[model samples]
Target: MATTNQNGGNRRPRGGRIRAGSSRRAQSEQTELHLLRTATWLFSERGFHGTGIRDIADAAGVAVSAMYYYASSKDELLEAVMRRTLDVLVSSGEETLRDVADPAERLAAVIASHVAFHARNPRAAKVADHEFHALTGQVRQDILQQRDAYETVWSSILSAGVHDGTFKDRGTVARLALLQMTTGVAHWYRPHGELKIPQLCERFAEMGLALMGASREGRALEACDVNLPDTQLLLRRAELTIEPREKPTGL
Candidate 1:
């Protein structure tokens, strides 16, 4: 039997379960997102060893059993968070460099993207940056591989700059320093703080060029005109929301 809904449209019979699949999927996604956000906050605040599955469930307003349905264990949840962060970082890096052919410009764009992502999603960045030690076995190896892939993006840019004489051959040291410097933004950047995202991106991009010894005046000028992507929008589209939490005290 069908019944008239508020819109004066016939509703399917209750036994039919017409909308059940899509409705359940949407609810599942929401629940999973909630769990991820909660776990990211807790892991960032308390460290992996300090946080437990029950803690994540309680904070997320879900039962432990329900949380288990999304992630079988805390390790799995941590892996998911880390993987999501890396996925965004890698994809954004690739997207930023797609049309950028000049080495100096590529390097600047990469730096800007890194800074923007870290500043926008600090907690998730912190977890991805600092919590790898807690993961063990296959998951740990997988995350490390992703980290290496991201590093390769930077390395290739640096290598190109060195090859083209646009940048000094500072080798791996420069690469590591640049990564550390840009990624460190996640530690201290605040949305309402004095430095805005665009400014930070420009300043950091300039600093990166300087660090690379890119002294070609015209090239440096052009390279600073990097187009930083909307990291917040990207994360939101990826279903990764940044939940508000207390300011981090220290590393």
Candidate 2:
């Protein structure tokens, strides 16, 4: 059901006890993630235009008024879903800030982290990138900002690698194309249905690296065409290559 834009994750509290310093605002965000995940499933199944506030409230097991407290309209709920999706991708970046000193390894972590996160939460992933145009006003701008920020993560990583000798990309086109190829992973990933996240991530990372740095092993990965159980990745890449990038129907 995920188109190409939305991304996602479900946040569950840990150990039956809130963290020692978890603040009230943090708890509120957790509640919103719960509501957003529920709405994502409903929206993906019913389509955003087909869903209603009462439907989301019922699906989330919350009062309609409670849903209204966080999102006044369906558009606002859509924005919430986008923010939640971006939050996951950004969170994965934060994990490597200090631990990953090498640019190549850091970028590898970024790709692996992204593919893994999207594979874990397909509905939210789809809603964030695919269903976000259904927003209005400042909310739409805010979602765009989050999305641009996510892209910047890729842009910055490539730029950094280019500065050093660890990686190489000819231009922004090549850089973006490589990143989009990885993003395409989410559009077709299925854990139980076919390939595992690690397999997809590792394989795609190899291709991205090979395209950029021409890593010897990566080149082999690119040439290795063992058929996967599901032809999702090949099919997705083929569709993306042919499909024109359409302008969004902005709300």
Candidate 3:
């Protein structure tokens, strides 16, 4: 015998609620974001091997079953977090620097955007910087593609600068050094610290330009006409919402 509705029609158990339209998509995105936030904190704190699906679900205030709605497994959840960071970095970089032809200005914009992103999304940045070895096989490859996309923007900028005689051709060494310096900002920068995002970006932009030999043209920092998108505006443009938290609070 099957359960019957008030009208006397038999009703079958539904596996999941079917949500339609923009409201449904918005809700799904929200849930996925919540999961990413919870997982980022855990993965950063406990290391990937120490964190599990139950840990993520518990921290997120959702049941383990609900997690399956967003991701098939914890690995997938981690990958989503990684992808979100890369998406913001790559999309924001390309969008902001796309129209600029001068390599010095383009590189300044890249540094400003990169630093601001790391400052705004330190936890996610830290996780992406530190958690690569934990990801396996195809997942790692896919994430690296996103990573490469972002890196390629910098590479192109550097190569163009060299070709146009605006920067020194120290080869890949200079590029790697610049990236490492800018990306490492996430490790120690704090929202309450003396330098805010904009100022921090400016400082790093100056440093990056100097590293690339732009100082010779007296275009090290303020002289360079870098029209970087405002950090908050850039985040909105990228559709990335990163809620700032205290250092010890699990993301």
Candidate 4:
């Protein structure tokens, strides 16, 4: 038999124990997600060193004790957030390029996926970009490891394109140039602005192919046509917003 709570929830008992661990796990996961969201906002606005554990706890509406239960310290929390951000980018890139056989198409897919991720996760992307100096020792190395792995995807694509005679700039400079250009979308993209997420991905994919010296004839660079997720939808999922900035006083 199962016990019913006041909220109409059922509690089952097995082996002299209640199935309360599932509920506890769900609560813990929710708390951790809130903490990550709060930290991403603070780090993007005030920087990693400027944000304190209490600030994150208060923003997430959790007690300081509860915050500590999830993240032992501010540095640990920062690393966790950054590590997760890079992990997401790496995983997304790999998944996006998995079925892309053509070298030019693979490069285009990488660019499109990168742009979408940044536009969706602006706060997390900004924190990852600006807070590298704040991490120390092993934490910095761990985050960079994930970053390098993600970069390798693009590097391999570029190398393959060059080998196939479809790309010309087969050097580190071209890779950094394309990456810097696409990653900058996080700083200026707006969900409800002039261009929607799909248009942005298309334009960015074209620009990336052009930067790589690939021919822009016809549909050769239309890599984002393979079902990339919308940036606005992803932003909504992460609960991050982008508002217009006010003009400076006496500008």
Q: Flag regions of model 3 displaced more than 4 Å.
A: 1-29, 215-232, 242-251
Candidate 4 segments whose C-alpha is farther than 4 A from its true place: 1-23, 216-251
- TM-score-wise, the better of 1 and 2 is 1
Task: Please provide, for model 4 over 58-128, each residue's C-alpha lDDT reduced to its tens digit, 9 standing for 90 to 100.
Answer: 77778898666666678766776677777677767777777678877777677777888888788888988
Sort the predicted structures by TM-score, highest score first: 1, 3, 4, 2
Cα lDDT of model 3 by residue, 1-251, tens digit: 02346788844222112122475777776676667777888887888889998988887778888777666677776676676667677777777777788888888888877887777777888888899888898768878777887788789999998898888788898889989998998889987899888788778887887787764355544434555557676555445553325332332
Task: Write the residue-wise lDDT of candidate 2 on 81-194 in tens digits.
Answer: 666567656765555343666556556656666666666656666666677768777767876887788778777877787777656666889667866776676677765766
Q: Total backbone clashes of model 2?
A: 12
Question: Each model's number of backbone clashes?
Answer: 0, 12, 0, 0
Q: How many residue-pair clashes does candidate 1 contain?
A: 0
- Of 3 and 4, the candidate ahead on TM-score is 3
Q: What lDDT score goes with residue 18 in model 1? A: 19
Alpha-carbon lDDT of model 2: 0.59
Better of 2 and 3 by TM-score: 3
Best by TM-score: 1
